[model samples]
Target: MVTHINLKRCIGCQFCVQVCPRGCFEYDFEINKVKLVNPILCLKCRACELNCEGDAIRIEKPIFQNFFAQLI
Candidate 1:
């Protein structure tokens, strides 16, 4: 899964940072925005997107089978 953080709309709520079960989001003190810290840990769960009040995060759904094939 690929997650993108839109810094513009983010208000430093840290809600996304708190809700991600895999610890995917991190609070960046300098930018005051939540960032994707470990994308590979993401389970493609929409919890972040649903909890983000500012709608600042987006997740890209990957065609996993196709992606896996590229490694060969």
Candidate 2:
């Protein structure tokens, strides 16, 4: 599973935090943004990325990408 945060596009709307069933996201009041507090806890359901209007989240890269990524 892949989970990333793009602060440039993220509006800190908390959509990811609210939609994540695994409690993988958290809000950082200091930065006025959301953070991936527990990526391993993600179920790779893509709910966070799909619900993100800002398109800042990406989960589960393609199978080929995952295979090669492990080699590196």
Candidate 3:
């Protein structure tokens, strides 16, 4: 799974930075916006996507992975 941030549409709200459980999102002072800094740390929890008001973040769901995860 991969997460994408549409900087062009981002409103710099920083909600994603606050909601991510794994500290995947970080605030960029130079850009005056939030950025996903640690993709590997992301838990695919959708907390950032659900809380983002700017609709700037997009995440690819781990569909097939979830099925395999159940079997493990």
Off by over 4 Å in 2: 62-72
Clashes of 2: 1
TM-scores across all candidates? 0.80, 0.79, 0.79
* Poorly placed runs, candidate 3 (over 4 Å): 61-72
- What is candidate 1's local distance difference test score? 0.82
Give the Cα-based TM-score of candidate 3 against the true structure. 0.79
Q: In model 1, what lDDT does residue 2 have?
A: 74
Q: What lDDT score belongs to each candidate, Candidate 1 first?
A: 0.82, 0.83, 0.83
Clashing pairs in 2: 2-60
Task: Give per-residue CA lDDT, model 3, range 1-72, as digits (tens).
Answer: 778889987888999988887898889999888888888777778888888889999888655655454244
Q: Please rank every candidate by lDDT, starting with the best.
A: 2, 3, 1
In angstroms, the error of model 3 at 6 is 0.6
Query: At residue 45, what lDDT does model 1 achieve?
Result: 83
RMSD of 3: 3.6
RMSD vs true structure, all candidates:
3.2, 4.0, 3.6
lDDT (Cα, 0-100) at 40 in candidate 3: 71
